[model samples]
Target: MLLYIHIPFCDSKCHYCSFNSYVDLFHLRESYMKALSVQLAYELKRFKATPGSIETVFIGGGTPSTVRPELYRPLFETLRPFIKTGAEISSEANPNSATSSWLEGMFALGVNRISFGVQSFNNEKLKKLGRAHNADDAAAAVLRAEQAGFKHLSLDLIYGVENDTKVLLAHDIEEAFKLPIDHLSAYALTIEEGTPFASIPDVANEKLALTEWFLKRIKKRFATYEISNFGDYRSKHNLGYWEHKDYIGLGSGAVGFLKDTRLYPTIDVQAYINDPLSIQSELLSEASIKTEKIFLGLRSIVGVDEQILSEKEQNRASLLVKEKKLIYENGRYYNNDYLLSDELALFIEQ
Candidate 1:
């Protein structure tokens, strides 16, 4: 089983961010964390997690570094017995708030990986994206994390925005390689509903050729494990999701999955604090689950198991194999190119 914890507080709201994070909820940080503990206790019992059963843990957010290490101590203590030996524990941090002290503190708590939200190394792009950190701050923060003894360091970069040139993206990749990071996630700028970018949709100008070129540049150094993810060290937490493993999601607006059911806790921070156990569940049909498996498997290194497909779908997959769009190995069908993952999944599904 896998575990995911959400921190719903941020230093500032990024204009392009539509996540369930808040800048005004600073006062409720302590109470919200306490509420997480309450829900976690309940989830542990509900999930029937055994000792050393959990393989990975990912702490994502608004920004996990915004919370102090002391605040995370109790949760780690509670998780210690359940976590397997050498489990990968990761946390997301922003360059501005992930101070040296914070990095050391989280490292001491047994977090082996740190994924920073360094959207871009270009100061102009950083400012336009409403990021709270500059290029220098991002560089320094990553260096600090390395000094803090984190072996698996990762950072994010945004691309396909308006005025994105090959030179600009090449520079971004150049600056990223200078850091001591083993993993990188390059995402295209997509305007989400209710985000500031939604009003100025033209700000997101994703050119397929540029995206392919940018990914190729990064792949020259690190291996591509997924369409957006490249790493010398692939994240076990990320792979767990693609493998459709059961996980416990702790926090408001967080989603959990167990077999065919999806669990959703309340999204309202105050309501969650009042009653963290209040959750809604969605049951996935066999067809829906199979569809997800196809999409996720195609998009990543994970290949779809042939046994899961119906006879008709298997025939469709066979056609792709004949066309050389997919490679049939052993008893699975693997995607050769992740760029066409969605289209391939749809064709098989249809």
Candidate 2:
């Protein structure tokens, strides 16, 4: 089993972000962590989590670094008995908020990995993205994490924004390689509804050729595990999601999955604090579950199991295999090129 904890607090909201995070809710940090502990207790019973059953833990957010480590200690203490030995514990951080003391504190609490949201190494691009940290601050924060004894470090980079040239992207990749990070996530800019960027959708400006070129540059140093993710050390928590493992999502704005049911707690921080056990559940049909597996499998190294396909879908998959679009081995079909994963899944389903 895997676990995810959400921290919906940020110092500032990015122009292009639509995640359920708030900048004004900083006052509720303490109350929110307390609420999270309440939810954790309920979910432990609901998910039937056994001792040493949790394989990985990921703390994502509005910005996880905004909260002090002491605020997180209660949750870790409760989870310690259920976490497997040498489990991967990761947290998402921002360069501006992830101070030296913060990094040391989290490391001392058994968080061995840090995934920094260092979207770019160019100051101009950073401003365009409304990022809180400049290029230098990002570099310094990452070095601090390494100095604090983090064994695995990862950072994110964004591409396909307006005025993204090969020279600019190449420089970004070069700067990232200089860091001691083993994992990198390169995402193309996409306009999401209800975001500041939504008013000016053209700011995204993705060019297919440029995106492919940028990915190739990063792939030179790290291996691509998914279309947007590359790393020498793949994240077990990330792979767990693609593999459809059962996970308990703690906190507001978080989603949890078990068997065929999806669980959601409230998105409002205040409401969640009042009653953390007030969760909504959705059931997934078998057909929908199978479809999800196919799409997820084709997008990463986790290939689709042959037994999950119908006879008609199997025939279509065989055709793709014959045409060199997929590789069939060990009773599973693997995608050779992640770019065509969606199209391939659609063809098989159709």
Candidate 3:
């Protein structure tokens, strides 16, 4: 089993973000931490002795580093009793919010991994994304994290912005490589509906393709271990999700899958705080699990088992193999290259 803790508070909202995050909710930080502890306790009791080891615990969302360091003590105190030894406890931080003191506090609380959200190194591009920090701040944050004794550091970079050139993308990657980071997650910018970036007229199909090429180049430069995620070491927690392993998610807007049921908590903070047990749970059918296994399995570097693909699917895989898009070896299929195109994967699967 794995665990995920969602911290849904950001210093400022990014233009392309649609996650259940809020800005300037500092006043409610204490109450939110208490509510999270209650939810964690409730879930722990509900799944008593399920016979599994938690290999990883990822604290993601809004911007976990934006939360007050003092408020994190109780939260980590509640979790410390349950987390197994050698578990990778990671937390996400935005460049602007992760201060030196904040990193030290998190390290003291047993957070060994720090993933920074440094979307771009370009100052103008960072502004366009409405990010709170500039390129220098991103570099400084990583240095601070390293100084705080964080060995496993990861940085996120977005590629293919409008008018973003290949040279610019290369420079961004080069800057990230200079940081004392063990992992890199580079994502192609997608224009999701209802985001500020979605309404911008500059976002074009050609720009999207350019972004894709940039991502491919990045994968080549920094060993792509998974689609959208590349690093020296793969994220064990995220791998659990791709492999369809069980996990417990705690906090508002969290989702957990356990014992054939999928539970999604209310997105509203107040609603979750008032009724911690008020979760929308559904019993997942076998077919649902099977479909998800195939979909998610293909997304990872570790490809699906040979038995999972039908004869027709095998033939499609063969076509991809011929096209040099996929390769079959050692009774498994892998993308011919490191980069896994979602559209191409869907086409091959269908």
Candidate 4:
């Protein structure tokens, strides 16, 4: 099972972010760690996770790098018995806070992979996005991670903003290749319902053709494993989710899946710190799981199994295959183009 730990702290809030992070609650770091450990230990026992059973551990958040590495030592000790040997343990970091010392310290604590939040390479674009780190900080962070002996490094790049030009994104992509990275997550900017960008004028989804061009160029060196992610090394933690594997979440604003139920911990940072064990859950219905399986399968390398769909849906899928929108082979149907995954799913389901 995959394990995800959310660290809800950031040095500064980004304009486009809606994550449950806090910049003003710096004083709560130490207490938060204690609370988190308490919660994680309880979860491990409740879930009955045996030693060397967890396949992956992904620590994500507002900026996991903001907290001192030593703060995580106790939690590591608690999880050590349960973590599988040579398992992929990764954490999300911000370029500004992910110093060389921090990277080395975390690595020593058993985190082998670091996914840096370097959203863009252009200084102006970084400013527009209200990112704390400059372009140079991002490049320097990657080099620092390399020098620190980290084998797996990934970076995130945001494209498809309002009034953005292809030349701008193309430059970002080119600069990305200049760094030593095994994985890349290219996300199209989306204006969420409550983010600052949502009120901005002209916010829209990226053009399909331009996105395809970026994916095509990236495929030259990296494998297009997911719709928004590409890499020589696929993320085991993310793949587990797409393939409907069980996972446990260990903090505020984190989601955990256990069989047919979805667990949602408190979103308020302070509240979660106060009562880490408290959680709200939703028991998933078969229809909900089936719909999710179809949608997730069509969106990534995981394809929908032929037997999962009804006979009518299967026949519709076959028609789509003939229309060249899907590829059916070995009792599974895959989306020919990820951009049309939703449309194809809707058509087949109808």
lDDT per residue for candidate 3 within 1-350, as digits (tens), equals 78888888889988889888898666677788888888877887776724335667899998999887788788677777677887898999998889999999999988999999998899998998889999999999999999999999999988656768888888898899898987888776778778888899365233656766777766665677677787777788878898787778888898998878998988898787787678899998976776676556666777766677778877887788788877788877776344455655576567
Model 3, residue 308: C-alpha shift (Å): 2.8
Clashes of each: 0, 0, 0, 0
Winner of 2 and 3 under TM-score: 2
Residue pairs clashing, model 1? none
**What does candidate 1's lDDT look like per residue over 67-109, in tens digits?**
9999999899999999999999999999999999999999999
- RMSD of each predicted structure: 0.7, 0.6, 2.3, 1.3
Worst 10-residue lDDT window for candidate 2 reads 211-220
Clashing pairs in 4: none
Model 2 Cα displacement at 202 (Å)?
A: 0.4
Query: Which wins on TM-score, candidate 1 or candidate 4?
Result: 1
Q: Name the runs in model 1 displaced over 4 angstroms.
A: none
Q: Residue 301 in candidate 4 has what lDDT?
A: 90
**Scored by Cα lDDT, where does model 4 land?**
0.89
Alpha-carbon TM-score of each model against the true structure: 0.99, 0.99, 0.91, 0.97
Question: Which pairs clash inside model 3?
Answer: none
Q: How accurate is candidate 1 locally (lDDT)?
A: 0.95
Model 4: residues >4 Å from true position, as ranges? 203-205
lDDT of 4 at 212: 79
